[model samples]
Target: MADFIPVNEPLLDGNEKKYLNECIDTGWISSEGPFVKKFEAEFAQTVGRKHAITVCNGSVALDAAVVALNIQAGDEVILPTFTIISCGAAIVRAGGIPIVVDCDPVTWNMDVNQIEAKITPKTKAIMVVHIYGLPVDMKPVLEIAKKHGLKIIEDAAEMHGQTYRGQPCGGFGDISTFSFYPNKHVTTGEGGMIVTDDDSLAEKCRSLRNLCFQPQRRFIHEELGWNFRFTNLQAAVGLAQLERLPEFVQRKRKMGAIYTELLSDIPQLELPLVKTDYADNIYWVYGMVLKDEVPFDAAEAMERLRKKSIGTRPFFWGMHEQPVFHKMGLLKDVSCPVSERLSRRGFYIPSGLALTEEQMQQVAMAVKELFN
Candidate 1:
């Protein structure tokens, strides 16, 4: 490889520094400011949500959504095992049991087909994570939730601008969360947002993000809340990002095409799957499966790719099998064989914004060479 290609890099242009400097000059760099509200509005418009309330990070976005739903302790919130630990963390913080399930090997998203079987009297909600920019099939999940009156919390931490049934990913759920971390589809340095169609829920989110204050009076601490606020400086960066949303989505899809065209015939790899109607799969991080024919385990594969200057990441460690939850006796009868199996066998090389078609070709060729 001529140069090391990173998985993802934020495309910062068009007055990013100017906007941040403006925030500093105004001396309103703290959480509450015009830029914060402006970014929230633009984000809401871009994602097709009625409201968007900015917060600290993606985990906090989910945390505020779950807290607003008022899930009682011991209530269960179903999620996928093939995700970052933040989803489980939010559920635990909200006093709910994190009911994790395996993902479909093809989509690598929550096994929506298995969800109904897991619903019970204690089930309160379902958090759908659109992993790798492939939006989860939401129609069936929504139907299941409606029949049982369960809230749907969308973790669009990875899937921004992705659509399902002509609707944006986040808008499908009762409450949706977005992560604007540096590496996400968009960025605000480090920030998160919760969006919702319900005005009451939106109000609740605003209150929750601002330490549960009454808002009418600055010092009237209405309820116990945390400091989950986004600074104006971060918001300034996000505003610039939001303006390029269309171009960003377009570029992502184009890069995805490069990966698909090159890897289509590689039996050792399985590309990301999609539903027929979505018409969108913004490549937040393009993922692929290394079939059993490959000699090395996922860790070894990552090590090999690293030596070649091709960065790769292993699949998420299955949450049910993690020591953190095992200590709580959460996995006594959990037998998600697929999740556990894939966690060890699968590794993925991301197709990020910085990679050119030529770089992707080199990546694919390197992997093929390794398998031989």
Candidate 2:
């Protein structure tokens, strides 16, 4: 058997080490260090936002955004059922109801057509999560938000460097959040950011992440907040990673192209949609859905691939199907058929920045062999 191929391995050969050494030499390793501010500034400019706030991780970033937006008890936020639980959890934590919409089968993103129907008088915001590599159709979403007078919270965590009709993904909403998990395009090991053009919202987020410390009295706090600060070490690494984002995006595209070329002939697989009208696929992960005729679900397929020394990861389970949500009496009777099907059949293969051409070929061969 060949060497095991993990689902994701980050490429950190650039200035990561140099930046870490600088942090150690300067003895500025906390969130107050200069690098944290630098990372936030550069990231805001890169994403076309006026301000960016760093948090401990992407999940908390969503939490902070929800609170900063003033999502009160009984307020409702509409989001896709086919996304990480963090999306819905944020709203629920704020005592707001999470309204779920179905995803488009092709793009694997929230179906824009179904959004308006879910809106109610209680609806305060629409949370748009960009899935895998393709962005949600934002034009309709924007128009809908405008007509309804609702805020937009864009989850561009998987869409670093991606655009929608030439506009940057993070620039579209009232507030946007991103994750720097190792699998992301620009990673800081385990960090997240929230960017916005609103000055008041930016300050609220900064305060939220730091226990709401008053500037006049360091020990004084006007309200409750979390200690969700990003360390200087992580920011140093993120700054270096951001510098190489273009290169990483290019490499991911190339990897997607290769996989599509190799796997297009498979009759049992449903490959990711290559391009939508607004943007091309960035292949955050080379995901495939088994056709209805296939004998096994993703779990069996992943186990088989593991035996062949190839790594695989299952897709996000729909929020409606989650047991925790059911226990909480949320989304109990709601049904999203497309999200359910995708969750059972979809899984991503190794397609990370660290993947080499040889590994790509080997993965293709292994996948083909399994189907044969």
Candidate 3:
């Protein structure tokens, strides 16, 4: 058997250890350290936001964004069904409804054409998720939001170095969220950030992140909030990772190009699309959708690859198809056919920052062997 290749791995060869050591030496490990402030500032500047608030994790970042925006019970948020459950759950938890739609079969991002049709009088926001490595076509989303007076919450968690139309993805929306999980372009062990230009919203996020404690008296509180504060230790790692983002993005694109070059001839597979108008697909994980000629779904394909000592991951199941959501009577009749189909047909191969050209070629060969 060949060496077992992992699905994703973090690249921590830069100043990760040095910054961590600094945090330990300075005894500034928690949320209230210099690195936290520095990280937030740098991240805010990186994404072109005026404010950046660090949180415990990506889900909490979404939660904080929605809460800070005051999305309430009677409000509705339009989003892509083919994204992580956290996007929908964040809206649901904030007393807002999540109205999901299908994806563009090519980009695998939100189908902008369907968004306008889903908007209702109760619709208060549009949550645009930059799925995988590709940013959503935000032009139409922005137009619809402007026409309908709806807020835009961009989820750029999977699109750290990706840009859309000469602008960074996170800068496009009213409030944007990012994740720094180990699999991301930049990892902080486990952390996230909420970025926005609105001064009031930034202050609201700060209060919400720290349990809504009064500034003068820490214990005194008016409304409820979570202890979603991110640690300085994590911020130190994030700062180091942020510095190397350009290098990371370049590597991912190169890896993507290599995968496309190696596997483009495979008739059974549909590789991630390359679109240069907005931004090139960074190929976050080099996802592939099987063509109809393929006999099996992504699950079976992944299983076969696993047997070949190659790891893979399936695409997100639409929120409408979620058993928990279905049981709760949510999206009962919603049928995002594209999303549903992609869920079954799509899976990603190894495209991590740490992946070498040899490893990529190995993955490509394994995939080709399976297809043949």
Q: What TM-scores do the predictions have?
A: 0.95, 0.99, 0.99
Decoy 1 TM-score against native: 0.95
User: Local error of candidate 1 at 158, Å?
Assistant: 1.0
- Ranking, lDDT, top scorer first: 2, 3, 1
Report every candidate's CA lDDT. Answer: 0.83, 0.95, 0.91
- For each predicted model, how many residue pairs clash, with residues at least 3 apart or on different chains? 0, 0, 0
Question: Any residue pairs clashing in model 2, and if so which?
Answer: none
Location of the lowest summed lDDT over 10 successive residues in candidate 2: 363-372
Candidate 1 clash total?
Answer: 0
State the displacement of the C-alpha of residue 244, model 1, in Å, after optimal TM-score superposition.
0.8
Summarize candidate 3's per-residue lDDT along 49-80 as a digit string, tens digits. Answer: 89999999998999999988889997999999
Residue-by-residue lDDT tens digits, candidate 1, 117-204: 8898999999899887677888899999999999999998887777887778788889999999877777887999999989999998
State the TM-score for model 3.
Answer: 0.99
| Strongest candidate by lDDT | 2
Error (Å) of candidate 3 at residue 302 is 0.5
Q: Which candidate is the best by TM-score?
A: 2
Q: Which portions of model 2 miss their true places by more than 4 Å? A: none
